[model samples]
Target: MDRVLLTKKGAEALQAELKNLKSVERPKVIEAIAEARSHGDLSENAEYDAAKEQQGFVEGRIKELESHLSIAEVIDPSKLNVQGKVVFGTRVTLYDIDAAKEVSYQIVGDLEADIDQGQISLSSPIGRALIGKSEGDEFTFEAPSGEKTYEVVSVSYDV
Candidate 1:
């Protein structure tokens, strides 16, 4: 049970999901199971089987969320005192030296990392390279494609 990092927003999102599962989804699955049971002929009840399966899935997810939330280290970028250094939750814009284009990514916890949404996992190669970088700093890392170089153009923590 290693502790996992979470952004404030990411923790909130997980909490919201847990709440929904408990308050709404759990009740719905229970009702559906009960209704399916009432249909009789348990051996041939497809609805009952499906409802039970859904219940199992919902219950498993609830447990997972609870476990993750229990050990989560929620970090709010706004409350940080990092000055201008790039740390967790800092949104950094980089100038791709070879590509000659500006790109930006928000360093987020692993569970909430979505590259499609411009969020990169803190353990990711780019994230590791960008960590502790101040504005106007240049660094290079071995990208999966090849060695890539980037210059830190800006670092921000937007509330």
Candidate 2:
């Protein structure tokens, strides 16, 4: 599998979720299954069926999180030597030329992309265009709506 890129914060969040699932959720599901089994009639028991379904889901998620963590290449923005260019884990301020609006975005890994939270995946169109660019540089790209131009106002590695 290809190495998965993850910011330090994103990796920490995933680790926390994995810990919760393993320690708290797994034990609760096991207890629920045991309790349901005590009720008898495993074939027709609705409680048993529900517990089994929950177990399957929890186990699947655990495996998925573990696989992701195993392949994760965590990047710490503060430790990166990107100079002034936009790169993964860099927060950038941009000015839209057509709309005359200013927006801020953090270039992050695909799994951590959340536009509402001002984070854009490195593979995204705007993020791809911004990579290797420095402040005061203007670039144009094709957006879904139309062609859009943006000027890089600032770049920082700080969160």
Candidate 3:
């Protein structure tokens, strides 16, 4: 199978979620199912059906987390020896010429991309354009609205 890209923090978050699912969510769902089963009337037991459905969702999430962790290629930017060029897991600061403001974004995996948190996936348009760009470089990014001009201000690999 193909490998999945993940930042160090992203991988840790996924592992924590997996652990919570197995240790907490799984047991909670199992207890709920047991309690519903004790209500009797297997044919018309709405509580039992709901509990079963919740169990299915929990189990499916567990499997998905496991599958992702199995193929995860976690990249820790702080430990790398990359130069000034922006890369996966590195935070890039840019000066938007059109907007006349500065913005920062951390390049991360697809699953860890959160626009609200200033995290962008490496596959995203701006992220893809930031690759190999160094500080004091001027570049044009094809934003959803239109082509925006931005200048690279800084690149940091802080964890």
Candidate 4:
């Protein structure tokens, strides 16, 4: 399987979630399952059914987290020699031509992307266009509404 790329902060967040699942959520579900089972007649017991369903969800998440952590390639953007070029983990400030507004985004792995938080996946349209660009570079990408043009105002890996 191909390794999943993650920034230091992303990896830590995932690790924290995994720890919570294994140490807290997993055990809590197990206890619920046990308590439900004690009521007997699982086929007709609502508590038992709900607990079992929750257990499935918790277990699935745990497996997914384990799989990701096993092959995660954690990169610290602050330590990279970006040399003014935009790349994964770089925080890029852009000037939208049509909107005439400035926006900031951090190129990150798919799993860590949160557009509301100014993080975007490297494979995303705008992210792909910005990759390898430097300060003052301009690029265009197809957006859902239409084509959009942007100029790279600045690129920083200070994070």
Candidate 5:
């Protein structure tokens, strides 16, 4: 797999999840499987089936996290000085020209992009449009709702 880009915070979160899965969830599932197996015929046991299914999910997640962490390139936004231009990990405040509203979004890696938190993937249309842009720069991109324009009001890397 290609190396995955992640913010420092994103990498820490993934690490925490991996730790929890390995230390807590994995052991719990193992214990549950053992308990279920002790209840006699495995083929007819609903508990055993459920435990096995849960074990599969837990193990799969463990593997996924491990893979991501192994190839993760953690970037610290606060450590960068991009001279006010919008770059990866920039918290950009924008004016939605068509909607006549103001909003803020942080350009982040796919692993950390949460739309609800105003974090957009660097590959997203708006994120691509905003890259290398400075304050007062206006850019347009085609959105699902049509051509959307935004003016960059501010860019901060205080993250």
Candidate 6:
């Protein structure tokens, strides 16, 4: 499988979910399954059916988390040495020339991209344009509404 890029925080969140599934959810599901089994009448047991479905879902999520964690390439922004140029995990400040406003974004992996939190995927159009750019560099790209231009105001590893 292709390696999945993940920021340090993203990797940590995945790990925490895996731990919770294994330590709490798994055990609770097992207990529920056992209790349902004790009710007898396996053919008509609604509790058993529901418990089994829950088990399947929980196990599936656990497997997915494990697979993602196994293939994740965790990158710590604080440890990166990108100088002032925009790179993966670097927080970039940009000036939208058309809007006359300043916006900040952090370039991160696909899994870590959360626009509401100011994290953008490296494969995104803006992120691709920002990569390797230093402060004061201006670039233009076509947006859905119209052509947009932006100036790189600053780049940093912090936040």
Steric overlap count per candidate = 0, 0, 0, 0, 0, 0
- Give per-residue CA lDDT, model 4, range 1-159, as digits (tens): 777989899999999999999999989999998999899898899998898899899989989989999999988777877788998999999999999999999999999999999999998988888889999888899987999999999988877
Ranked by lDDT from best down, the candidates are: 2, 1, 3, 4, 5, 6
TM-score to true structure, per model: 0.92, 0.91, 0.94, 0.96, 0.95, 0.84
Ranking by TM-score: 4, 5, 3, 1, 2, 6
Task: Give the poorly placed runs of model 5, Cα more than 4 Å off.
Answer: none
At residue 102, candidate 2 shows an lDDT of 99
How far in Å is the alpha carbon of 136 misplaced in model 5? 0.5
Task: Please list the C-alpha lDDT of all candidates, in the order they appear.
Answer: 0.92, 0.92, 0.92, 0.91, 0.90, 0.89
Query: Tens-digit lDDT track for model 2 on 24-94?
Result: 99999999999999998899999999989999999999999999999999987778787888988999999
Point to the candidate with the largest TM-score: 4
For residue 81, give model 2's deviation from the true position in Å.
2.6
So what's the TM-score on candidate 3?
A: 0.94
Pick by TM-score: 1 or 6, better one: 1
Worst lDDT run of 10 residues, candidate 2, spans 75-84
Is candidate 2 or 4 superior in lDDT?
Answer: 2
Query: Mind giving the per-residue lDDT tens digits that candidate 1 earns over 1-159?
Result: 877999888899999999999999999999999999999998999999999999999999999999999999988877888877889988899999999999989999888999998999999999998888899999999989999999999999983
User: Candidate 3: which stretches are off by over 4 Å?
Assistant: none
lDDT of 5 by residue, 83-149 (tens): 8899888899999999999999988898889999999999898988899999999999988778999
User: In model 1, which range of ten residues has the least summed lDDT?
Assistant: 76-85
